[model samples]
Target: MHFLQHLPHFIGLERLDASEIRLTQSVITTLCGLPALRELCLYMPSALARSEGRPFPNVHRLELLDGFPFPTTHDIVAFCNKFPNLRALASSAGYGGLLRDLTRAEESSIFPVLQEYTGTLRNLHIFARRSTLTHITLVDGFLFSRLVAELQGVAALPNITFLSLALITSESSWFDGAQIETLFTLFPNLTELQLTFMPTEPDPQILTWQINGSLDALLSLLPSTLRSISLKLDLSDYHDTRDPDLEDDFSLLFDYPHFPSLRAELMAKCPALTYILFDGYHFLFLWWKTSTSSVWEATADYYADARGPSGAT
Candidate 1:
């Protein structure tokens, strides 16, 4: 509390990360006075039940570290109202555990101009239709059937331009023709996507080869507007397979036989596609120039790009 009192001394402070600081009335009070603060990451306690109504118009991004207990309707709305210019909000895994039975009327009042969000899919509908959320990252993952059921009650989000979904499948449930169309219909403006898949069913009849068979064909069905795509696989559950990077051989999961065709197929299908990536324990990044293509070996810089402002997956 004493240290925070001195914080306002720095008139040019533009970013404040209070993830380790406890949530207190004094903390919020001090933050409200920072006119130049553009980003804030606050650690919220689960017991918080109400909000301080003051507005922070300059803050464009807010992160609720270790997301507090899903707040009540009034509490959540009031909390969001504090940041009128908040364009991006990121929450920890704890935030989206439950569904808030907010009425359409209540949903429309939240996040008036929010454009980017990173949270669970369960809570996406809360802001998707009303807000201009163009960049989204569903950190907790998603299922096609569940998403369909959820979207039935709400409207499709046509403003989404960048999307990242984590998928957990038993057999090979990653790709489907209908799913691709549904995604495009939901986010017609989508240009960048990142997909992460994890296999749950041990010793399933279908192998990685069969999955790629669908991948080769289904990828062609993706929206032509897509310019960059990233795919990551987590295979720790299969046949005592260890981390892919630690393993000497990876032929079982990533096949050398089909790489060329898959790459070529994607390049030709999406004429505007500029970047393609296969990231996991092993990684490969490819980019297309005017008439030629180049490969980027795995590097720390590539990982940063995947999570940077322009690309979030």
Candidate 2:
């Protein structure tokens, strides 16, 4: 990492792909010295000390490969304080503690980092491992509601244009139709969104979500600014046993018979949406903007080419 010092003109630095490289305070200080550094990616280990009183004035993008052991809210606050101009922030959860920290934060003491970028930050992404949610208590719907509340707090992100969150576990609660609507309300200016949901147990009764309305109600909740969206649903854990004959059957794995109608409704309700990707039952439904007659046609063709006639393996 010392070589970075010689390249003072460097505008971007990414060492996340290097799993062996552990970032420490001194290395961070070295990177901060770069006069033009605008982006940085690093793998931060737990308990790593942070430098004080130095801000990355030019940096607008920051990505942390591993969730830093933010020992306290002050640590996260201090880190955000250092990147005053940050426009995008991405973090991976080493455990579920990060989510707990964000959700449990008192309303009076919201995430200071997000508050810092309330006007400038345009993109936010959080990916958590399944083990992270294991410690949380699963009640009627407390855990899911808490998670949603944490996201809702981000309504302060009035200028945010993109958001992605992938936190899946067998015990995690599903986001029913109402929760989905609340999500769009929280990020009203979002131009793109991506989400993944997966449950752990094999209880057929518990795995499937019971949305109150048709898919149109869910799709209509999207903000007018949204141009693209991706939803990945993993229901493999719902089955008690795997049948060899149906192992390769995609349609039998998950049920969404109204998918075609949903696509049509989406096009009608959200004309700005140029693309939609829905993957369920191990089947993929993709749509892209083109000169084609219908967006659904494009999605069907893409699905057919990718999955073949059976559409599942």
Best by TM-score, which number? 1
Error of 2 at 211 (Å): 6.6
State how far residue 295 of model 1 sits from its true place (Å). 6.2
- TM-score for every candidate vs. truth? 0.80, 0.61
Worst 10-residue stretch by lDDT in candidate 2? 130-139
Q: lDDT for model 1, on a 0 to 1 scale? A: 0.66
* Model 2 spans with C-alpha error above 4 angstroms: 1-30, 45-53, 67-77, 94-143, 151-161, 165-174, 188-190, 200-216, 219-225, 236-250, 253-260, 290-313
**Alpha-carbon runs more than 4 Å astray in model 1:** 45-53, 93-99, 153-156, 202-205, 237-257, 280-285, 288-313
Per-model tally of clashing residue pairs:
0, 4
